[model samples]
Target: MRFTRRKSTLWRTFESRYYVMTLLTPLGLLGLIGILVLIIIYIIRPNFQQKVVSSTYVWKLSLKYRKKRLPTSKLRDLLLIICQILVLASCAFIIAKPACIVKSTETNSETVIIIDSSASMLMSSNGKTRFERAVEAAGTKAGEVLDGGGEVTVITAGPKAEYLCEKETKENKESVLREIKGLWNDNQNDIKCTYGSDDIDGAMTLCADTVADNPKANVFIYTDATYVNGSVPEGVNVIDVKGEEESNAAIINATVTQDQNNYVFSADVIRYGTENTPLSLKASFYGVNDKSGENGKLTFELKDIPVVANETYRITFRKDVEYTDEDKLRGYKLVEESKLVLCKLVADTDVTTDEEYGVYSFEQVMFDIAESDAFDFDNHYFIYGGKKEKLKVLYVTTPIDKNGKGEENPFVPAALSIAKNYFSSRLDIEVDTVMSDKQYLLTGYNMYIFEGLKPDSMPVDGVTFLINPPKGDYKEYGFDLGLEITSKGSEGDTLSSNSSNKLLDGLKAEDITVSKATSLKNFTGSDDSPYNYESLLELNGSTVAIARNCKENQTVVMSFSTHYSNIAYGHIAVLMTNIIDYYFPATVSGTKLEVGGKIEINARGASVIARESGFTQEEFTLTEFPATLVLTRPGQYVISQTTYFGQDLTDTIYVSIPQSESALTEERYSLENPFTERDDSDYFNDLLVYLAAALVALLFVEWWLHSRESM
Candidate 1:
């Protein structure tokens, strides 16, 4: 607003810095010639002839008129000459051009404005995202610096530090504004405004380097200060732009489980901020058929849901939707043809209010009934309603026991039956006993237990348990079953067992008593061998029970025979259940992945598709067996693929906002003298147009006076 002439050696020579020197030269020359011509014309008077008058009285009147005319005409001519000279001089000066420089005593400072672009910046209040507010704050700071003739550098801190506009001058401030306002474009792939985990260290490093290069430079960071925990660079000022606290409710955890032939959906919802008002939450369930078509829908509304700040509330919904024939057909196709039964759970705010200061939030979570099993808040869960497949166990025994009775050990079958019933609530288990010499097939059995006998050859693939096997019989199955037998009535008491092993579930060393047993020495392999079995139970430093898993086939060896031991009625039942559960785990545990993280899954040359609740679906094709998927947003994602067996497989994964971003608490920081003084004289404006207007007014005044004199 304020302008003054700057004092400089170059400016002193030019006199006016706003105009071209070449144009001023010709205009000055023309003005000088016009002034000389006017002076010559005034000095050289024209010759005139005298005229006779009628009488002496006429001569007197004519003399009086001539006197009046001479004074008036002389005044007019003087005024006209002065006006012409003024016009000529003004024209020459206007052509030379003039400029007014802004006056300031402050020194110019280079400034860098860093804006936080993390996912936390997406928090909205008053219909504006935190990032939008931060950008506006940054623009204000840039304007102040630019107005003072200081250069500005705008940097955005996202997954990495990026420069939006570098070293922008006051003349190009508009360009910087455009870049900041248009940070997010139509293309989501553009990383300029993509939401990601905050990388404050990376951004701070960039600021540190900038300050190191220019020791006196000013750096201003604009953010909500939610994720900033580490040290900041020296001379950097942080401007907190966070607004008032806004209440939000998030579905932190969701799970689906089957109970009594019905699917139960449960969710853990947490409220943030200080508002203790009750929020109405609506839960909707959408069932998709085999062709990915919606068939059945169920809606549940919970009004006046009491929610305490920072507290979690549990919400449950049972299967209330009546399925039609089409829905049943879709479920049947999902189980038989490998299609997927899709279930989507959406949560939203029931009441919409126009409160300016209050925040009404909603979140939707999706689940697939066919693909999910594990209970996790960060991933979608699937509930399988179909009957579980039974585990087939092949129990092989010798024709005759040492008792000389043809009947096998009753405790063996009793223990198997007890273990089978224990898991019957969740799993189906079937045990088939056969003689070792019988022509039995091991194709469909999931497990093989050998009692005092060995198979002709080891089962190609399955879990196998060897109980009291003869040393010579195990040699053919690549097992070094070296057993050292003592007297006939020899007994070995259990010394110690691995507590971490699931197989030793309820069995204690004192509870196990083997009346007739042999010591297993070097049973698995040599001491220096790398393929040794892990000992599950030990007696006096000798292995009583050891197990090993090789190429998906788990094998267990027990030195004592169950026929002579009381382990059958004791923890043996629990041990059998543990072994069955271990080999056939309910769910395959995968790597824990977070929001905006990457994970690799087996695709098997099938098309993999992933979709979040209320978002567009993304599809990927595997060139190889496994492909990597990048999670960009937080929600329940249903990932589906087809296997070579013509079975459709789908998985549900849940991703949640990071704890650091969800907390929504502001951090305070302090600094001393973070900004430097800026010089404001560089943006001087030209005054040539004002000078030209003044010259035109003078010409009009001169013409008006001349016309009045003639009248």
Candidate 2:
């Protein structure tokens, strides 16, 4: 009468057979589903009681079979049930196991990719930067996260932790992907750095804090493994781009110590991995003699070390090179086979005197760590053991600095006087009335001054003291023409005819000679301005100076001549001594730090690094050693030291401890066992899920029919 048949009769539930026959317990969800099915069927097809009667005796005869209606109805039901079973069975054969795949209502996640943009990542891996590989990997992870309803944040590392993107969405996938794909790998040249401190630790730590309120964030660190381990923050997941299966050979360390006679060529060659790699190690030195003759000389051969995975190879110069002024000032050189040499200069007092060596220093006299409690500790024994047991000083005539046209600049005097007057007691102060000749900072003092140089030619290392970078230095590149003075000569050198004096054409100083001063700064009469000659460090002029941390823990710098005024000179000794003292981080308790030890240095007050293994503090004078104590060894060591700020201000370092195995001197390591995986997919649930989808469709249809009837 309805002109239609029950489509339910033909509909099939593909996985019903297994659900009914399987010996496994029905899942709780399935039980609930069964209950729902019963309710739906009862509601959709409820039968009412019926009364049937014959109109007359004849009618009763015709309706004789009416008494069997109940049985007939029951029989009909049995047939329908049987037909349904057959249909479901047939469907089950076609689609064996069905599953009820449901959408998860859980929280979406966020991923932060911190790529290592440091120059070190420039090394080629399959012709691409390890940085590129890291970005690719991060992108992949980002895709997964996006697919899962999550977001991505990109952070980069170099001189600064570069935030390339913040919380990009799937909707912006094209732009985000393009941005990353277009990125070029940045190399770690150890040059082109804008800041003295490449605070990767601080960068990541900031990122972690940025996402602190976001519980869904996971930070991925993509790097070449340059950071000292302990410095890693706890909250973020580190995704080291240098894969666990990393095979790398590097010149990790090199040392060169010399004066005017000996030129030493020393190096530390290292190969590390889970597998062995062939390494051709050679050491060579290249320099120009006084005659300007090219001298490419000497080679130190290293015995091939057949090392196991995660091992190192070390080779030192058997014969130390003769000491030369250049060697101490220029630093050491590390040469890799088939690669250019990476060199670092050392300072060992090039300008020597009967009383003491020339010492120049710069001070961060106003620093934030002036309130640390670790100053009283005894962990400075390392400083006491070396040739640096006592402070050294150099004495010279007046007027520490000058400007072009032989005028006094306020900047130089202020910079030098600050370190000399305030930090005198703890330092081996040196005073040089005039600048010297020689390219090295070690030639005369533990520090050098750069107040007079062109601002644009700022050295890669060294503290720059000023409101502006020098004329030729990067700060003022186009404004004036200033030549980058090579480290070869001192401040008093005569200006070369070929040199451009336009940078200093209008420059003049009270006590300096014009010919001797070719560097200058211009000012527009701003009372509080640093470049303004008035009120500049009590000298009514501008000055320049530098302080840097270099080889074997030395911070060599230069102080421009304008800083040599009597207003500054009287305090030079104290400033110099204090700066030198500041170089030695004040001692904390526990004088001797043991190998594989935890030495906490609580730095209180202003401090800066001086020559090798030295640190000075206004309130405390002690030394702070580099991470791992010995660069040769590998281990987890923490310099739990901190400034008073309770910000983990101390350098927390975890050195990768050396294994005799690294030297391939002990025993070789072999893989003890193969890897295995455990599987956990629910084969039953998968089938059930598919079946549930069909059931859901059927349920919707039945509910619609019931609602129509109710209306």
Candidate 3:
């Protein structure tokens, strides 16, 4: 039941609050207080009005009127109270500004920094390597999160996927920024993620898998426009950075090749864009002649390339061509490998009858083998840097006619036919056909095929066949098949009649199994010393199948030709394949490329040891070596090093370089995620808005408090 009344005063009616900065701008508080005092006395005073009231009974009503009109603190104490509220509000607002600068608790935070280290990142995009600028920009934003006490994980997006910083330990601004400064677009720098081939598809999956384990975590991906072709992970924030220039075209194709002559080389060229893209092509062929001058320069005829696109050309060389090709397209031949090349061919004519019915087929066989290779030199005459795909055959025939007449021409006709048959078949072996005639001597072949030709003149160069030569010369020309020498040689190495060659006096039951040699009837006791092979079809007096020896090379001698028996043809072909596979060997030059290559290759139990520019030499040792070896360049390779028993052998890898500019456009963009937003994006803007609102509200409160204090 309190009653009160008052006459309105200018200072009492208007309240002017004062602003005081406690620690900062303390002088500002004094100026604000002075203005408040002035406003209350001068500006507010002239407008002051008075209301009069009287008697005690009226005062009671006046008290209710006062409470209704005022509804505030004691008017007598209003000046002090207003001064206190104004000073406090100023301090409170300044402190509250920090809250506006920060964000709400996002709970667990996943900050992924996807740095672009692709080839395009090397270009100056926005004044720096797109990579360099990206790292700087990412660092600034990472600070905001770390400043807010959140954790961060830094990732790298390049040809190799990696993590520069793990999402471990409490995030520190200094440490994060420090890591950013040391960050490099190289492997030795980012060792956490082992480098693999460029496969962004897998990398995208990895990015998602990394954070998917922790649900409700926010993801921030920062990168350049290299990842245009790649997909962004789910629930990820993408902060994309784009460079100012995307117009540079670089040479992406550099490849190596192997030719028919076993020569190796590499070629690369640049393409130009017709736009204001003033470009240069500088090719330094390493591991070869260092002609740094324009002497090695090669220019192209194409011109006016489209913007961001280029017209490309090539530079090529080989080992056999002359060093001077200034006028030719294929220039500068490397040194040639000596060509003491050995060649051979097999005749289709089979001869494995107990008797000698020799018809010569050497001429026809030689002619066909040469003609078959005419289509492409690589198919037919690839030299012996290694071996080619063809069996090595040993054709042994006598120059005597079926009737034993010494007609050289007649015997040769049938001999040549035999050669054709054997050559076309699996005996598709390379052979040196020895002739008794002075006109045609054995040359250029690895194994010898004697067709009734005198074994006397045949050198020990290859396998020799003595057609039932009176076991005399056998001591020097053959292996000892019997327990002892049947006859002795005049000289230790002479293939004369006295050569040690013998047959067992008596045949044992197992000498030739009846089942294994059904054809051997009356020929059983005949001296089988001339032939020493696992018999395929043996007849009584002689064998249609046998094995022979000349030095380390094992030769099989059959007693009949296809002219003698059709049955021998089957065994002949089988033995031919086996023998050829044994002798005609193949050598491999492993995969070779410029250091950083596209397609990596490997062969069975082998490694590329030496590489001079483009030539990768892959070596393999002989284990039941085959007589032929073949290879193709720029291919998906499957190399094998298996023993004759198919046991495991050594294995090595080779890789081919990508060609220049063919698909320089094929390798698409890098890992730039435009859809992935930065964790502190428009959020920073939101903070700014809060700071602005807080500052404005602060001004009004202080002004009102000062006006009251002045009264």
Candidate 4:
């Protein structure tokens, strides 16, 4: 063997034998100091006794010694000394602590498995879904890894990539297998795959991070995905779990629109992996507000609809439509949509098509493919088109004159009339006026406006506006009004406004002048209270207009009268419009969203509850206005909440799957591994016992040679 002073060496005992020797403890080589001591001992000469009659006696003794000693005897004596030196060297080498370095093999390694859990994985073949097959494959791979004294990690690539098991060894093999099997829904049919798109990049990133410390770790991805050209990395292995080609026809999208006096239903159907297959669509509508027994829940089917593979075919269902030649070419069909029947029958009964009857129309419609395809989940879809609730406003004012003609503020009424048109497209607004002394109810209104008067208590559900509140103690509403302060001159006092406040968005504070303004004090201080206050308009550093908002209700108090302002004619309308817009915002900006789409939700009640039929249910507390909601699955979601007034408010929205996930035969994306390969796989084995054996053999040989010389 060749020994080196550095990290390792080569040890060879025979012509074909080979071993890579590594020094585990190089400090042990200090034992070689014994070689120097042995040399010093051999070099020193022993003292001899002095004699007088030596020459003749010495000559005779030397002659006798020479006659008895053969030439080979000296060679034996030299060999004995060499054997002793070799024995000493063997002890030094044993103390050096050498070992053999060998490369690691598959018996011990680290492995990571990534499973695709997207909607496309729900595709079934022979009653077994692709997700199930992927789980089985992952479990097999994990079992093999654990049996070989290796560690295994399993991660699922769903809407969000997460770990199923991390760094599991043979000791916990049973628990790891149980977790892998839990992915399949054996007992219940709850969805096993995510309805949203797969996070392939995120899964790969997690895998890369996991194997960062182990360069020789094995990574396997079990999915039906086919990578692009040269996309798969060198060390990773992707097992495609897809079987034979399967044909699928799906109703990808559906919508409902209002025509002149009827409703029109439209749907887009698409086929995958099949050419020119005859398809049919069936639709069922459930009437929610049809008081007239004329329109029951109806179902209709259109057969032999022509659709091309991978091409969207749009179908329309309407009543009393003359089919033009162009319409025939565009694939328009004449079917009695159920919503049209409900609306037409109700109109025949001579009922007004206002808020009372609008809600009684179709709430939800179920559309399905007549012939079942390989993938059943995409075969059906739902459309929710419920009517929105109207916003009701109650305005109560005191008369300045004895006549009832001055029953309400003319400026405030005019401003509300203008707001009715501005918010016409978003909400249906209704205004009711009443005298403060006359009988009026404080419940069941979205907004309460009081002028020159204060109610006993504010409504619990909706917002409230107090314009020029009369001097009184209003601790019931959590505030008190003090004596009024009039301006010294006819020019009046200039108002100071908060520019950052959204209530004063368009109104200019410098131009406004108030002849008299009341002092406001002693309101609740905590932000959680319903009377949480922020000054919007201030006169001489005292608040004249303030805005309060909390979870229970929202309020706006304007202490100054509009009649005293120099520009009250035009400015009052603008100020009133801003208050209406800020207090009563739309609940949902959009009613239709696709998977992975986000929409803003303005809570009108204590919280917002979003629920889909049998799939998803989530609740978000109404901490602030305009919270964000993300649509992770496709279904008919009903967004509802309970106001503090014990009224249940609801709105329906539709979420649909993206068009990209419909093509099961096509590969969506590819992944690449970023990890590096290990260059060195060497280990060490101790050789101290072998060196000790060699020392014993050397000592025995040295004794035999010494005995021969003595004889």
Number of the predicted model whose TM-score against the real structure is largest = 4
lDDT of 2 by residue, 1-711 (tens): 567654462344533423333313333323344444544775699678767665888878657765556576566555544444443443443244433322222245777776665444443444554556777887787777777777887766655566777788888877776677656535422222221112355556656544644654677776555434354444455555543333445544433333333333334444544456444454333221211123222233333334444433334332233435643453323333533223332222246552322112211001011111111111011111111112223322222243323434454445455655444433334444333222333242333344333322332222223222333443221122233332333433322222122222222333332212223333223555333221122112222322222222222222234332332443343434444454444433333332233444434323322112212111223454431222212222223333322222233222221222122112212211111121213223355554556555555554554454433
**Candidate 2: Cα lDDT at 107:** 41
**lDDT leader:** 4
| Candidate 4 residue-wise lDDT, 228-297, digit = tens | 7778887788888876766788877777776553566777778887577867777776764543243646
RMSD, one per candidate, in order? 24.0, 22.2, 23.4, 12.2
What's the TM-score of each model vs. the native?
0.49, 0.30, 0.38, 0.67
- Candidate 3 — worst ten consecutive residues by lDDT sum? 362-371
Model 1 regions lying over 4 Å from their true place: 1-112, 123-129, 132-183, 192-219, 225-249, 255-265, 269-313, 318-441, 470-472, 480-484, 487-515, 518-546, 565-633, 636-651, 659-711
Encode model 3's per-residue lDDT on 1-711: one tens digit a residue.
987876467645432211121222224334345445644664455555576566688878877776775634355245544544454454444443322223232447656555654443333434455456667777876776677666666667555566667664354667878887666445433422212123344445455555544445556654433234455445555565544434443433333333442323223333323344422322222112222345322222222222233543333323343335432432222221321111111112236653321111111000001111101111111111111133334444445565644644333234434544544422334443433444554543455655433455544444433332222233443333222121132211111111122111122212222211112112122365433334433344334344543233344443333333332323334443344333332334333332244322222222322222223344423333222232222222334454222233222223322332122123344433323343643232223355456556755665675566544
* Ranked candidates, highest lDDT first: 4, 1, 2, 3
Off by over 4 Å in 2: 1-109, 116-124, 144-150, 157-159, 185-213, 217-246, 274-279, 287-711
The candidate 1 region of ten consecutive residues with least summed lDDT is: 355-364
- RMSD (Cα, Å) of candidate 1? 24.0
